[model samples]
Target: MNTVPWLTILLIVPAAGAVVVAALPRRHATLAKQLTLAITLAVLVLAVLATFAYDPDKAGFQFGQSYDWISTFGISYSVGADGISLVLMLLAALLVPVVVLSSWDEVDGGGAGGGRIPAPTATPDATGGTPGGSAGGPGPAGDVGEIGAAGEIGGVGGVGGIGGVGGGSGGTAVALAAPAPAPARPATVPPVETRGEAETHGRRSVPAFFALLLALEAGMIGVFAATDVFLFYVFFEAMLIPMYFLIGSYGPVTEQAQRSYAAVKFLVYSLLGGLLMLAAVIGLYVVSADNLGHGTFDFATLRQMEITPGVQKLLFLGFFVAFAIKAPLFPFHTWLPDAGAQSPTGGAVLLVGVLDKVGTFGLIRYCIPLFPDAADYFAPMVLGLAVVGIFYGALLAIGQRDMKRLVAYTSLAHFGFIALGLFAFTSQAGTGAVLYMVNHGLSTGLLFLVVGFLVTRRGTRDVGAYGGLAKVTPVLAGVFLIAGLSSLALPGTNSFVSEFLVLVGTFTANKPLAIVATCGIVLAAVYVLYLYQRTMTGPVVHEENRVLHDLGLREKIVVAPMVALIVALGVYPKPLLDIIRPTVTATYADIGKSDPAPTHPAAAHPGAAHPGAAHPGAAHPGATHPVATQPGGHS
Candidate 1:
């Protein structure tokens, strides 16, 4: 048994770092950010070290530590990492630093209006009528007065301004209609602009943002490292708080109400799922009490108990529903689009990349092993949902106008592929599903980061706003194209390998379903390539796009590692496969299933004797009959 409490240390470092960073003086925003980055890097180094120390040949969970807590209710503070948990921990660690570096200038308060654009001056009509209205008529309905220099809107028809109508005759000058002075930028609140567009954005609290980010990291790590079921649930629900604030406080939308609405919606959906899981957890304890003579929340111990089929089904739905919502599978997925579109770039990366994986991970970790019979019982329904999601999400992705929403939709489809593989119940499919989780994080995380870079430069997420960006920002375009290609599972990119494995494995188990799921690949191609063509090719129709600069040094640093990993994994996935396959095999074994033997026909060798027939002069009393030789030595 390993003596070091590696998982506990991993959890504490980030939790403690968040507290420290949050306590820093407001003026030390830079220091807070730097410290946060250093802490994330440290976590990454530790994760790497833990990876090295792991023994894949071992039979069960490694680096495990357990201590009693809440003994009356059979709860404990236990932590450990299997292969699946370890890789995910590494992914979260790797992406946090990248997010921080990419968002370095995202919240620096400086420049005109603290990086926000001054309100545009209204243009007068040809007849010199009131600005933004017909001559001698009321200004366009619902038009507010110009924003003042201090970022406040001037009141209409007040002491300092005229009414909706300019009170001027045709071809006459309106003396009272002077434009409002520009707003003064606040020193402490920096605008939430991307790196290059720091000159024109609104201010958000930097220290608060980083602090929330660190807190989120702690929660994510905890969820994966946790060994106690109740503890897992605790970490699962607790992570939502930081993400709620991150989305509500730092979203790119200038309107606070919109951000708040998205945040609320996300919280509501997650909380509902959490409630279901909580009930199931209580149900599980009751069942354990009856079966084991006492209620306990230990995951391994619970896995050893055999519950009746009916109770297993009921408990399964509770946990499965929660994970599905987290997975945001099909109908449960409505909140993700809004959340992803509204969140800031870094927030979006973690939201979709690492956070959503918790759902699928739960399905593998808690749902299947603990309720094997129920998992099998619900397999058909889940498979149907997975196939539907593949088509539905892909079609919507193709139709989306907003860049971030489009990416969000694509994840919905990718999760479908993951779900399909997991339920297929073969080691190959299960391994592919876990690998897909890691690869999706890298590919889609990179996509969100690059899109964020574009949004920073252009200050918009509309797909229509860009045309021939490659003309000016070739490097950015290149990265975007790579990310897009990987998303579509282009043959040479990382997603392709995992996606291919998923299909092949699914094919072995359910040929018809696998065939139908394959069409999602075509739809994926349409959305990914069309998005690239529309945004990066053609004439530079908008002049604003002409002057956009390519990726700067910091931005290049952000993308290079991701791009390298995508290509490297695409070409050779053996290392990850080696780490992932054993756990996948064991996971499937837990449910009493194994890989199905292939049914393809094999050619008979010329002049070979039929095996069941006794060989000439070789048959004798009590002699064993020789078996027919086939490919792989299977009869």
Candidate 2:
């Protein structure tokens, strides 16, 4: 029964719910919330069951389902999950429901920080005397003062299930990296704000946007599950529409500078990457036809086709570029922080939690398997870049004033770790990278949701403005502590287990890189502790902060599950590792057999002319060369 094409149902039900949600009467807020929550919850339940039912020992796609879609091109409405896709899909299904619930009170405008799109022009009855209505700007003078107060009476709400997990050392290190906030310079909003019109159109076109979100999900799921290259391209290209609306229309504080800039930047980068990938995909299909006697976009077929080393190197660039931008790796990563900081909390959650994983996923699924030699060839450069991202993102995060943007840069660091684990060429690293993707989604998504609440109440994203908040909102403080700690890879938390695996695996392959990566763990503590200290510690200085409140039932319920998983996965990672290990082992075996050993300078010098040329048998003119074998080893 579990094998009955569950992926299709997982993709379709939310889509159907979007339709149901739009048709309901505008006044029926309760029904809308209930309907959306129920649909997302159902998806979660199914996805969970699918995860359990999945056979990790299996070497190929399972719960496989296919139906002809574009017969002429051999495209099919097909879906399946291997260990990699299983974890990612589970990540998506788990978070969407939580995000929905977190927004229940806000969208309904019935609880703390209540605000929704097409914000009521006049103060509504449900706002409970909160001033400034629902544009979600600062409320009365009291609300403004509360923003400045830190250690006042417990006015903020508790984060129920998501708080109280351990691993504080790891998480704290990341948070304490800096004390000051980035200077706030006013943004230049074009007088016309053409983006504003698009947003208005999107709000009026809620049904359309919702449909697009579902469609995006469908494409993302397909991209992960696809066994065929052309099918992957089709789904990959389809993702842009929903994301465009999610950024352009449903963004938080749509009138702000970040929103418009993020939306446009995201579109340009994603589209450019897609076009380059499209050319590569077409080229691969043509090559397969000529070489293998069939024009096929199937992943299995392409993997078996033996293209020249030159072809692999060139083609790898096209695919790698696309995936890196999606992964938003270091240099290509400029657009992500902006999109994450300004977009709706839900959009940000999905973008970081689920979508970003696609890039790394592509690395494992397509890059390594199809271009093994190229991947081996490029390993050093990739590892170097990953290291840079880890440090650069942490430094940037430490300097952030906006809490949302802070969360965004931290994710960049996290992605760097995941990428390092992946290209490090150890099975342990690969499994860790896969599991990290799941843990990141759960933890980061929760962080964004919680921060959204903060923004909702305070009308600002500035960290310095908040002082000793633990006294006012111990529950929120606890929630932030857990989420921040998890981000920092605290022990007894899910992130710790995966991060440990990555470090352990990376160290096994490259000790110096591992040592450098460990510095990121320290940086993690610095930024995370700073975030916690600035927001939740100290005395409540502002007079207005004296009356602020803490977490209510709705917020508690939404946060609890995510926090629970952080603990569960942290303590009992064996279950997840057990599943991921087998698949990773199989993939690495395939890749390793085809590619030569990656040669770092240390391996190449054996007491050579310089430390950079540490290995004796370096190959290729590219900077630290990769060698097929040790100079002393038998052929």
Candidate 3:
């Protein structure tokens, strides 16, 4: 018994922090921001310690914690991590503090509504006197939603969302031109009475955005950490709620429709998958109850139950639907580009970086072991789809005008390689797929953050809208360039190492598929360089860009760690591969026992019917009499 339940503490602390922030008084906004920052930083430190404390030499789930919550129903509160889960968990923890601090000024602003308050105002009384003298308007940094939308109003929002600007009036002009109606003046009642309270209330609600994001973090971590099958399903469905709110409430106005549509699509797809998996889980429990003597939803217990081959296929399909929808694999991946393009960069970072890994992770952790026969039967088709996704995603990314969507599509291509490596069933491929998860999070997350910062400065997500940005903001352009190169898997970047391993292992398993996938790498270079050319290499576009500042101190801080990780992992990836190899080997061994037998008697039990062969009973004493290692023969 491991006395310290570090995993549980890791989860509970964040949930508690979110609750504290959500309940904080409006007057204590600064305190709320600081407290939330402190909590997120604390979680990050623990996650690091958890990584250090993790005994890679140990065989299975370490830091295991379990408690029966509904024993009668075979349900329990459980959390644990293997190498894969630990890596993803650490990524989540690492990003949370950065996200919090990046938005600190916005979420913790004074009552004047500056710094991310879109509709900031200072109210006046009956005499038109300022309630608080000279409350400066929100600076160039508007609300995240407002700033993210920038210049896409006509095409993105159908022109309704962009309030007209009175030229040459600066911030005050834009503020005065807002679409809201003027206050109804009364001789007896002051005009300030009408607008002041409304404005104040709006300012107080900014913290809710942070609360929503924190809640999303909690749900995402739980999904990665869940141990029991039913518990996993529960956390799986719970994630959509917070993500739904994150997009619908705090999301950018220009992409509002696209964001809402993507969220609903995600919800519907995920729900259908969940329901199918739920049915399969129940069916498995019923079969276990009949044969294994009692029902249980514990993954470990379920793993040992001897399910029939046909039944395993059905169960596998149910789980595959859920994971595929989450993975957004090839044909099922339509929702990703839209969501990634429309979501705030934070949302997109987590979406592409961490959340997508859950899908591929499920294939390794659950599907293959739980239904080995089906996995073997379906291997070729899965491999084909992975190859298809690679070429298809890269080809589409080459045509993208929206910078964010281009990044999203590139991820699709990257995931395609990962999926291919995984189902290839080679140990090296599997290890590479696992490592790809961590590397993708680092590289893609950095790319999205850097892109968001550029969009903030340029006021557009259009790749063509930017040019010669390196000349204007050298530091930012350099960060963007490095991030793009990492995305392209250039030599000495983390993605390069993982992707190379995947291609190498995949080639060993499926030569033609690997060859086709190599084409995707070429396409990656084309689009990455093309994107950089469009955004950073040409003549400077509008005069507005001439004086744009370079990467700010906080922005640099947010990105530096990710850059270091990418470079470090690229230079030396052996440590991650070493940790993953043992587990991958064990998983394959567990499932390798499910290989099917031949139908013909002579072929099925070739050794059994041969003359002078030793009795099969001599091989296994525990098996009833003599269980046949040979196919289609009774012991």
Ranking by lDDT: 1, 2, 3
- The lDDT of model 1 is 0.78
lDDT value, candidate 2, whole model: 0.69
Best by TM-score: 1
**Once model 1 is optimally superposed onto the true structure by TM-score, how far is the C-alpha of residue 605 displaced, in angstroms?**
13
lDDT of 3 at 482: 83
* Cα RMSD (angstroms) for every candidate in the order listed: 9.9, 13.1, 10.9
Predicted structure 3: lDDT = 0.68
Clashes of each: 13, 49, 0
How close is every model to the real structure, measured as TM-score? 0.84, 0.79, 0.80
Compared with the true structure, all predictions reach lDDT values of 0.78, 0.69, 0.68
In candidate 2 the C-alpha lDDT for residue 410 amounts to 91
Ranking by TM-score: 1, 3, 2
Per-residue accuracy of model 3 over 495-586 as CA lDDT, tens digit each:
88778767766665677888888888899999889988988887997775676667777777888888888888888776675566556656
Please report how far candidate 2 places residue 107 from its true position, in Å: 3.6
Q: Which candidate leads the pack in lDDT?
A: 1
